[model samples]
Target: MANLNPYLSFRTEARQAMEFYQGVLGGDLEITVFSEFPDMVQNPDQSDLVMHAQLTTPDGLVLMASDTPDGMPFEPPQGFSVSLSGNSTQRTQEVWDALADGAAITMPLDTAPWGGTFGMLVDRFGVPWMLQGDSE
Candidate 1:
C-alpha cells in the first residue's frame, strides 16, 4: 500500500522541531546527526546538525524531516498545507488542537459546507496543515 507521509525541511533546527513534535504527539523519534555519516561530516561544522529524523507515533503517524545541508538554502514557501482527513472526528479534533498550538488558524475547525469538519492552520514550525473529519 502507498503511504502518505509529510517530509519537513528545516534550516538548522530539524532535531529540535522533531523533538517538539514527539512531545506534542506522543511518538518515538529517531534522529541521526551529520556526524553519524562520515561522508556528510566532511565539513566539521555540520557534524552536530541533524541529517535526518523520523517520528513514528503510537497511532502510526509517520513524519520525516531533515535539516538543509551546510551549503543549501531552506526557504519556506506559501500556499501548501498538509491535509489530514478521516472518519474519527474526536481523534481528528484532538490532533487539530494539538497542532494549533502557537499557530495561526486560517480557518476554525467547524462544520464545513461540504459536510465535514475542516480547519487550516500554520503550525509553529511554519508548516501549514489542514485537518478534516467526517460529519457525524
Candidate 2:
C-alpha cells in the first residue's frame, strides 16, 4: 500500500523545529546534518545545518523536514496547510489540541458539512496544518 507523508522545508531551523515537534507529538526523530553527507555540502558553514529530519509518532504519523541550503530560495506559501485525516475522532482531537497549545487556530474543530470533524491551525513554527476525522 502507498503512504502519504508531509515534507516541510525550513530556511535554517529545521532541527529546532523538528525537536519541538518531537516534544509535542511524542515521536522518534532522526536528523541528519549536512556534515553527515559530505558530498552534499559545498559550503563549510552549512555543514552544521540540518539536511534532513524525520519524525515518526507512536500513533503512526510520519513527518519529514529539511533545511534549504544556504543561498537557496525556500519560501513556504501561505494559505496552505498539511492536512491529517483519520477515522478516530477522539484521537484526531487529541492531536489538534496538542498542536494548538502554542499556535493560532484559523478554524475551530467542529463538525463539517461533509460529515466529519475538521479544523485548521498554524503551528508554532509557522507551519499550517489541517486535521480531519473520518466519518463512521
Candidate 3:
C-alpha cells in the first residue's frame, strides 16, 4: 500500500509554517528538532532547527515539512500550487478564510466559469495554493 502527500521544504520556517497549518486546519502535529538526534545534530547554532514535522488533520489529511540544514541550498516554492477542494462549500470557504489571513490573494474566491468557486493565493509562508468548492 502507498500513500501520497505533500512534503514541504523551508529555508528555516518549517516550524512556524507547520504551526500555522495546524491552527488553520485543526490537526495534531508532531515535530522533531535537529537537537533531538545526536547523529543528526548539526552545529550547536543550528541544532534547534526543525528536522521534521508532520501535521495530521481531523479530516485525515497529512502534511509534512522540514527545514533545510545550514549550508544547503534553499529555494522558494514555485511552479505549483497546493490545490484544495471539497463538496462542502461552507467548509471550504472556512479554510479559504483562514488561509487568506496574511496571504496575497491573486484571485478572489468566486464563481468559476467551470461552475464552482475558485481562488488562488501565495500564502504567508511563500507557498502557493489553489482553493475550490462546489457552488452551493
lDDT tens digits by residue: candidate 1, 14-132: 98889878876788999999888888775787788888899998879899999887677678847677777874778778888888889999899998889878999888888888888
What lDDT would candidate 3 get against the real structure?
0.89
Candidate 1 least-lDDT 10 residues:
70-79
Model 3 ranges off by over 4 Å? none
Question: How far off is residue 87 in model 2, in Å?
Answer: 4.7
Q: Which candidate is the best by lDDT?
A: 3
Which stretch of 10 consecutive residues in model 2 shows the poorest summed lDDT? 70-79
Which has the better lDDT: candidate 1, or candidate 3? Answer: 3
Instruction: Write the residue-wise lDDT of candidate 3 on 1-136 in tens digits.
Output: 6898888999889999999999988889999999999788657788888999999998888999999987788888888888888747787788889999999999998888987789898999999989889878
- What TM-score would you give candidate 2 relative to the actual structure? 0.82
Q: Highest TM-score among the candidates is held by which one? A: 3
Report the error of model 3 at residue 57, Å: 0.8
TM-score of every candidate: 0.85, 0.82, 0.94
Candidate 2 regions off by >4 Å?
1-3
Clashing pairs in 1: none
Candidate 2, residues 5-99: lDDT per residue as tens digits? 88889988899889988877788999999998899998998898988899999989899999998678888647668888884888778888888
Each prediction's whole-model lDDT (CA): 0.84, 0.87, 0.89
